[model samples]
Structures are given as C-alpha cells and as structure tokens.
Target: MEAVRATEIMVAAGARELRDGQTVVVGLGLPQVACVLARRTHAPALSLLLEIGVTNMNPVDTPIGLADSRIFYRATCWSGFLDILGMNLHRGVVDVGFLGALEIDRFGNINTTLLKEDSGKLRYFNGSAGGNDVASLAGRVIVIMRHEKRKLPTAVAHLTSPGFPGGRSRKDLGLRGEGPQRIITDKAVLGFDRGTHQATLLSLHPGVELQDVIENTGFRMETPKTVPATPLPTPEELRLLREEIDPKNVYLG
Candidate 1:
C-alpha cells in the first residue's frame, strides 16, 4: 500500500506549478525536492539552475546542499556562479525561482536573518547568501514554508529578501522580476492579489478548513469567493516522490 504524507502534499503543490520546459532556479531544502519531482514527473525538459552554477542536472540522489556534487550527476553545463547569477539570472531569463523563509510578511517580505525572542533579544539565523539575488532576478518566485501563525507574521522582524516591498509594484521598486508569485504551505496555498499585492488564500490543503487557515495565518488574508482544495498527491506522484526523488526521507519526512 502507498501512503501520502502531509509534506508530500506540499511538495506536489510546488511541482504542479512547473511547466514542461521552463528554467528554474533552485535553492536548497524542499525547493530542491519539489524541482526534482517536477522534472521526474511532468516537466522532464525543465532546466534546473543550481546556485553552485550547475544547470539541467539529472541528480540520482537528494543533494544535501548546492555544493553537493550530486548536482553534477549528469549536468548539461557546469559554469561559475558569475555566469549563472550575473548573466542568466540578472537578465531575468529564469522562469521560476524556489525559496524558503523563517518569517514571511503579508507583503511577501522574507526574514531569514533574525527573529525576536520572548526575552526581547534578537536571535540570528543563517543569513541569506543568494536568496536576495534570486528574488530580485527570477521571473517569478515561489516560497515553500511550513504553515504557522508565528512564521506568517503581519510583518517580518527584519527583511532579508524583499518580496513586493510594501506591496508596491515591481516597476516601482525597479526590480527585474516579479517578487513572490505564490506561497505554498502545509495548510494552504497563498497568492498575491493582483491589485493589492497582499497575501490571498488560493486553496486549502485536504482536511484544512477556512477557519483553520485563518487561525494559522498571522495577518488577515483575502479569502477568495471560491477557495478550492489542493489536489492530493496521486499514487504515481507519491511513488516517484518517495522512491525516486527522496528515498532517504531527507526532505519529505
């Protein structure tokens, strides 16, 4: 018997957004797993750009990070970070960029640098190395994060990477790409409203109700007139995700 885990549902939601032939800039974490699932399932022709300067690699195992050599398993090209980031990404040629954050605001700003503690002290986290650059360049960014009230704050304590700064137009900020197109969470999927650019509930995961989403979110989300439930992972998707993509349960677990 095949069982679908809740985490797998989030992974599949990320994969469903990918197209057949698009260039994706992949960061570490579940974003990597989601990209791999996309390639192996529907978007076989997807070109993956690793921060380490590898592109279109068919990895056999789940890589620990961008520096993992598994990224070079059968790479189409091995270039330097300069060529990938400066030339390609800066030019906004990459179609989709996947990211994760510890704190996200209603405006989509992300804070991975620091968080406030109960004692009123600032606790530092791993700083954004290339995330800011990626958000600034990718044609569209999709953030994958665990859903929790605290993580989804009304405003991030510190902005490590700008999403739609203050929900302003991308043109207003002189950004090359549209910031944070969608946010995939364990409980629901949120997208930016076209006019307001505020986080809007797009769909809820299976068994997650409207109130459940409302309670978990830190800020008030714009509820759509008709919020659909995210499609559950099919047997095939679950099999591929579990057996082929992340057999070791690195990210899916």
Candidate 2:
C-alpha cells in the first residue's frame, strides 16, 4: 500500500466493499473504477447503475465519466432518472449506494452543497444532484471521501445526506435505507459505534498509522483494542485496475 498511490488504495478499498451480485448505484469517477475492478475480480456479477440511467454497463474501456459513451457498450438499458432513482431506489431494489462528499461529520452526515466560510460566506457547490435520492432511498449507503480535517468537520454546515443526524435514529427520520453502513477513506475503513453513534475505527490501511487517522479527522473517533489492517490489493487486482479498469490513469492516476 505504501508503494501505491493513495487514490489507488482508495479505489481498492472501495472495490473490496462491493459484494458479488449486489445491485449497486455508483457514480463515474473512482467508484466506477471500483465497480469495474470488482466485476473483474471477486464480484463478477455485480450490477452497476449510473446516475445518468445506464444500467448494468460492461464497459469495454475506462469511461472518463458518465457522459462518456464507452459506458453504453453492452449496457442493459438507458432509462430516465425517474426509473432509476424514483423507482428502483425508492422501491428499495438497490442494495448499496455510493456517494462522494464535500464534507462529512463524525456522525457521517454529509454536505455536498455549499461550504460555510469563517466570514459566514457560502461557497455554493452543485447542490445535491442525485446524492439526496441515493442517500435517502438506497438499502444502505457507502460514502467515499478522503480523510482530511477540513473535509471531516465535526458537523457539516448543511446536511445533504442523513447519517444518524445528531445521533438520532433513521426510523425517526423515516428514511428508507439503513443510513450509512460504512465510510471508506484512504486511511481507514470506519463503521459507526452503536452506542455513541460516532465513527469507529474498523480497519486501517496497510501503511497508515493510528495517529495519522486521528490527527486528520475533525472529531474524535473511537478506537477498539485491536484494529485490523485493510488487506493490501493483490497484484492481480492492481493489474485489473491499471490495465483493465483505468488504464488512462483517469482517477487512479
């Protein structure tokens, strides 16, 4: 892991979370690379849903983005947003949802909208796009974000995706999914502590230290007595990622 780039490690960590035959809602960037990697390796039957309505795409080449026509090669169908998000997701047919965040709190609440500056200025972002739907309706959500103190605030200025907001229950919010099941970062794999509703260290990356994880986070995360290191990416896995998935070094670069 030390020899590899951080983004590569992040992609590997992301790819490992996907299980065989699970219908996953994924975006175009690193998540798509992860999906392609999963299909080439252990999870050959994993189905991918792109936000732009392409379903079950078997990409012949690494697509630059959802707008790239390469994803349409042997795609299952090209439905509209209503069918994918309004129906499949709202109906709870999707098993997992992948989301990226501008900021995430210790409770996992996400902010993909505007960032509030110290002067009370709002720096607007593309407000939610399909993130709200994906987070709200999927069976379970897995967030992909790089761990940094600025991005990992104690709380987001705005809550675009609910993740145990204020340490409450999802049932109370009436959200369909199980909220955030896992948070995958370059440094560690984290899961919420049931008692504290705070991010807890589930596993660390191969060369990342506990202090590194702690110092980078905006809030204090609970650490167990024994934390396992995330399994290093296999050589075959690396090959698939480099030669097959993202040969152009699009995201893995």
Candidate 3:
C-alpha cells in the first residue's frame, strides 16, 4: 500500500510539468522515480539533467543518486559535477525541478536539513547540497513528500532553502521561479494558489476521502467544492513501474 501511494505521488508530481524535449533537474528519492517514470511512460523525449553531471539519462532501474553509474551509462552527455551546478543550474535553463523533502510548509518552504523537537533535540539527516540551487534556478519546482501531520507542518524549524524569501509576496516569488508549483503526497496531490500562496487540495486518490487529506495537513487549506479523484495507473504504467523503474522493489512491492 505504501508503495502504491508513493508511486501515485511521484507520478502525480511528474504529470504536473513533464513535457517532451524539456530539460529537468532531478533530485534523489521520489524525484528519481518520477523522472524515470516520466521518461518511460509519458515524455520519452524529455532530457534529464542529473546532479552528478549526466544529461539525458535513460536507465532501466532507478538510481540511488547522481553518483550511480547507470546514469553515466545511458547519458547523452557527461560533465563534471561542478559544471552542472555552476553552469547549468545557475543559468536557469532547467525546465523542471523535482525534489523530495522531509517537511514542507503551506507556503511551499521545504526542510530536509534537520529533524528536531520543541526542546531543540536535533537529529540531522543529509545536509543541504544543491537543493538551494535547484529551488532557486529551475523554471518550475515540484515537491514530493509523504502526507502526514508531522511532515506537513505550518512552519519548519530551519529554512534551509528559502521559498519566496525576498519577494514582496508569493506571486512575486513565483515570478523568479523560486516557489514550489505543486506538491504531491501519499494521499493527495496539492498545489499552492497562484494568488494567495495557500496550499489547496487538488486531487485525491481512489478510496481516499477529503477528510483524510485534511487531517494530515498542518495548516488551513482551501478545498474545492468538488475535489477530483486521482486516476489509477494504467496496466502499462503499472507494469513499467514494477518491472522497469523499480525492479528491486525499493519504491514498490
């Protein structure tokens, strides 16, 4: 069930922006899965720019990270890691940015730096690397995370990457392409309102109730009068997801 939910979230996020012949910067975890799925199922012509400097990678299995050799094996072009960060990312040529986070706020701010409590007990995970650049330069940003009260909080302890930090408002922030365009979770797919920057429930998966989504969110949400149900993965999509992208069962059962 978790596998299905994770895949659902990945695909939902992928479907929001992936287009043929576009270049995308993909982070690790769900972002990797989503990129692979998009290349195989939806946008075969899409070019992937991996953080480790492989571009247009088409791999049969999901890689652990940019360092995975499979990415180099299928890449159309390869460069130094610093080249991808300093030249490609900073130049604002990436069409889409896919990222995974431990916590995300209603304002589209992400936190993958630390896990802490009210008492300041900190348990650190992987520290921020190129996430700041990915959030800053990509044309569009899509966040993929699990839907839970603790994970989707009203605020994060540390603002590792700013979401609309300097802009006068959310709309102004989006003008620079810094704020998140969409958020996909286990239970539902959500997006921030263009005008208000408040998280809004966009679609729910089959058998998932609106209340289920509401309960997991940490802030007040704008739910539509008629929320749509998420389309189930087709047999071909399922087969590809299970057999090609995640054959080792890391993301699926």
> What's the CA RMSD for each of the models?
1.2, 1.6, 2.6
Candidate 2 residue-wise lDDT, 1-253, digit = tens: 3367677777788888889999999864777777778888899899888878888888778777778888888998998788888778877899999888899898888899999889989899978888888888888888877888889888988899888898887887787778787888888888987776788889999889999999998888889888899887888888777778777887877
61-139 in candidate 1: lDDT tens per residue? Answer: 7887888898789988999788788788887789998998999999999888999999999999988877888888899
lDDT of each: 0.89, 0.84, 0.75
RMSD of 2: 1.6
- Count clashes in each candidate, considering only residues at least 3 apart in sequence or on different chains: 0, 0, 0
Write model 3 residue lDDT over 1-253, tens digit each, in one string. Answer: 2245456545645654688778888888777777777778778888788777788877765666678786677678888657776677777677888888888887777787998878879988776777877887777789887788988888866667656543236455554464687888778888878766767888887888998889888877999999998777766676777777787867543
**lDDT score, candidate 1:** 0.89
Q: Can you tell me which runs of candidate 1 are displaced by over 4 Å?
A: none
What is the Cα-based lDDT of residue 194 in candidate 1?
81
Residue 170's lDDT in candidate 2: 80
Per-prediction TM-score to the true structure, in the order listed: 0.96, 0.95, 0.90
User: Lowest summed lDDT over 10 consecutive residues: which window, candidate 3?
Assistant: 164-173
Error of 2 at 109 (Å): 1.0
- Name every residue pair that clashes in candidate 1: none
